[model samples]
Target: MDTYTTTIAVASIVTSGITISIGVIGPALSEGRSVATALSSLAQQPDASTTITRTLFVGLAMIESLAIYCFVVSMILIFANPFWNHAIA
Candidate 1:
């Protein structure tokens, strides 16, 4: 491939790696914090375990969506890269 195409591929790979790392790390930390807070709250209000569990699940799902989005982006970069065609053409 030409230099331009190589550059595009390299840049896309680097950017995708960084983006995936950032997306995963932020959500992982947030999930950890959420779980900690939820546990503490449950400890304080043992009777409200049901509500706390429900809210925790919701928060976890939201956090997991970020990771899923990052995975999608990474997969796109690896398999269905648009920049490859744009750069080569």
Candidate 2:
């Protein structure tokens, strides 16, 4: 209700929005590009399909983790925010 709470509330909302947008967009774009490249490579080399497929899965998982981390951080900021106590006082 006070300035402190107002500031924290606004900041948390903005941060969460930015975090989710960047987190989702970056991974989405990366995954799309990775898939495109992998498909192109597979089309060029049918014999290496198995190896390429395995590597693509691993890379996708790794890329996905980045987005997951961002989601976690944003959730923390929005739900379990450390600054909430200060703002409440």
Candidate 3:
């Protein structure tokens, strides 16, 4: 591989890793906190367990999408990076 390609490859790998690391940390912490809060709410209001659970699931899904988007971006950078084209060309 040419120096350009090598540089692109290294940068892409590093960027993708950083993206996942930062992306996951936020969602993971938020998910844990949200779950804890939901549990407390349910405990205090057992009659609203269904509503709380439903809301929790929806919130979790939305939070999880952030991680998913990061994963997809990382995958793109690793496998189908547009930069590679310019580097090789």
Candidate 4:
């Protein structure tokens, strides 16, 4: 393959790798920390368990969206990259 093609391929691979690592690791850490906090709160105030649990779910969803966004961006970069056409031409 031409240099342009090789370069694009290498770039895409690197981008995907970085995306996966950051996307997975960051969310995992955030979710773990959030759960730990929620559990601690629930233990301290058992009466507020319902509210705490509800809020925890919402926060977790929001945090997870970041990972989802990262996944989408990586997929776009790998499969539907705007630069691919330019490089090929």
Candidate 5:
């Protein structure tokens, strides 16, 4: 490959790796903390288990969306990168 193509490939790979790594870390930590907090609240109020679980699931889904977005971005970078076209041209 030419220098331009090589550079683009390397950059895309590195950027995607970094994006996925950092993105997953944040959400993982957030989800862990959220679950811990919810568990503590549930322990304190067993009567509210249903409400707490529903809210926790919703919140977890929202938090997980961030990781999903990062995965999509990384997939685009590695597979359907626009720079590939530019490099080819």
Candidate 6:
């Protein structure tokens, strides 16, 4: 409710938004590249489709985890904001 709290809230929201965007964009691009590469490899080597598919799944999982983490951080900013309490106190 005070100026400090207002500033913290605004900063937290901005930072969380930026972090979410960066986190999502990077992983999205990485996932897309991974899939494209995997598909290309699979096309070139039909016999290695199983291995490529397995690796592609692993890469996708890792990339997705980053986005999930960002989502958690954004949710924390919007709902369970620690900075608000810290600023008030």
- Residue-level lDDT for 75 in candidate 1: 82
**Model 4 ranges off by over 4 Å:** none
For candidate 2, lDDT tens digit of each residue in 1-89? 59889899889989999999989999999999999999999999999999999999999999999999999999999989999998786
User: What C-alpha lDDT do the candidate models reach, one value each?
Assistant: 0.91, 0.95, 0.96, 0.93, 0.98, 0.89
Rank all candidate structures by their lDDT, best first, as comma-separated numbers: 5, 3, 2, 4, 1, 6
The pairs that clash in candidate 3 are none
Off by over 4 Å in 6: none
* Model 4 / residue 73 / CA error / Å: 0.7
What TM-score does candidate 1 get on C-alpha atoms? 0.90
TM-score of 5: 0.97
Instruction: Please count the clashing residue pairs in each candidate, in the order shown.
Output: 0, 0, 0, 0, 0, 0
Q: Estimate each model's TM-score.
A: 0.90, 0.92, 0.98, 0.93, 0.97, 0.88
For model 3, residues 7-46, the per-residue Cα lDDT tens digits are 9999999999999999999999999999999999999999
- Model 1 has an lDDT value of 0.91
Candidate 5 residues lying further than 4 Å off, grouped into runs, are none
RMSD of every candidate to native, in Å, equals 1.3, 1.2, 0.8, 1.2, 0.9, 1.4
Task: Please provide, for model 5 over 55-79, each residue's C-alpha lDDT reduced to its tens digit, 9 standing for 90 to 100.
Answer: 9999999999999999999999999
| Comparison by TM-score, 4 against 6, better one | 4
The reply for model 2, stretches above 4 Å from the true place, is none
Q: By descending TM-score, how would the candidates be arranged? A: 3, 5, 4, 2, 1, 6
Worst 10 residues of 4 by lDDT: 1-10
Model 6 TM-score, 2 decimals: 0.88
Q: Alpha-carbon error at 67 in model 1, in Å?
A: 1.4
Question: Tens digits of per-residue lDDT for model 4 on 3-76?
Answer: 99889988998999899888989999999999999999999999999999999999999999999999999999
